[model samples]
Target: MHPREATAARLLKISAGNAYDPDVDIDWDAPQPPGIMYAPQERLSLFGTPLWDALTPDQRVELSKHEVASIASIGIWFEVLLMRMLLRHVTGLDPRSAHVQYALTEIGDECRHSIMFGRMISAFGAPAYQPAAVHRALGRYLGATAGGIQTFAAALIAEEILDALQREAMADDSLQPLVRMVSRIHVVEEARHIKFARDELARQVAGSSKPRRLYCQIVVARAAYTVTHSLINPQAYAAVGLDPARAGAAAWANPRFRETLRWAGSRVTTYLQELGLVEGPARPVWRAAALL
Candidate 1:
């Protein structure tokens, strides 16, 4: 078998053993424990801002709920785009190939994850927070046009960032049980998906010409900016009874939140930098996104 096929075959076997049905695995009906934050205190966008200090402890916890719901909503949005990109990726490829089969399996995993996110949003009684209109439209464009390495790079940006956050949440005993369980499930499953994307991306980048690699870099950087900026929707602030405009501005300007963005993105940025995918014009964009 080709080396790519060998890698895919290994992933496929691992996926077979590790796949989850979130609906069955999560206790959807379990009551959310009182006083528990939905995410880490430091992870909140308004953390260390005056806005954060003004809120009562209970209000801070509520804000965390809205923020986590917003993250899950974005996860659903990105997973849908990813599934579309994966379908585009498999077009004309041999359906029986291990690569194609693993891609299909990953799509199925994303489908469950989207549904799981929707359920979590419902459980929170929070509106499904969406990206701003312009970012939503940009995501649609990228979903249709992103191919090869661009697709995998974009996937890694969203996956690894969320994975980092979820990894922390799952291990935090102070968080809501619902959040912990959900994060645990997602973190476990996404590990395989991340490995798959990283492997495929390295292969594609290795074979790509300078021009194509540059194009992928620019596109992926812009997508990274969009994802980071859209993560904590202004609506999450609104949900917590704050002025959306001011809270959103604070988050963008907050040094603590900016540091959080860097921390969340550090792993993927290092990988992309090593692949030489973070150079050229993309460097400034990555810096602007606070992912450099």
Candidate 2:
């Protein structure tokens, strides 16, 4: 077997023993502790801005709930994109191979994760935040066309950013019980998927021709920008009775929020930089996305 297949074989065994059914594993009926925030205050988009200072503590907690829902909504969106891309990825490959089998396993994980996110949103009593029409169109395009390095790079961008935040969240004892449980489950399962994608991405980038490499650089950078910018829907602010436009402007301009973006993107960005996929025409886009 090739080295990639060997890695997948190992992953498959680990998954067999460790995969979670969120529906069964999570205590959906558990009582949430009152006065707990849904996410860390520092991670909230408007956390340090004037708008944040203007809100009462209760309002701040409310905003965190909505923001967590918005993030979960985006997670569902990206996982759907990932499911489609993974299907396309294995279409022409040997189905019996460990690599193909692991890809399908990941698809199963993503499907469960999407459902889990939807349930969490409903539980929060928040609106299901959809991406803007333009971004939905871009997602459709990427799902249909992204392959190899482009596919895995986009996967890493979304997964890594969320992973960074979730890792912190799961360990924070002050967060809502449900939020912490969900984060812990996701973080454990996603560790395998991240390794799979990172290895596959490195292989693809090493073997890709120059023109294909350049195209992937720009395309994946655009995806990174889109995903980063869309995580906090302006409508989330509106959910808490704030002006959507004003709150969004504050979030985009807030230095603390920008720093959070950088921190979240740092691991994946560094990896992609080493692979040469985050450079050339993509550098500015990464910077503009506050992910450089």
Task: Indicate which candidate wins on lDDT.
Answer: 2
**TM-scores for the candidates:** 0.98, 0.99
Position 16, candidate 2: lDDT: 95
- In model 1, the runs with Cα more than 4 Å from the true position are none
* Model 1 Cα shift for residue 86 (angstroms): 0.5
What are the lDDT scores of the predictions, listed in order? 0.92, 0.93
- For model 2, residues 40-121, the per-residue Cα lDDT tens digits are 9999999889899998888899999999999999999999999999999999999989999999999999998999999988
RMSD of each: 0.9, 0.8
lDDT of 1 by residue, 32-110 (tens): 9888899999999999999999999999999999999999999999999999999999999999999999999999989
Error of 2 at 265 (Å): 0.8
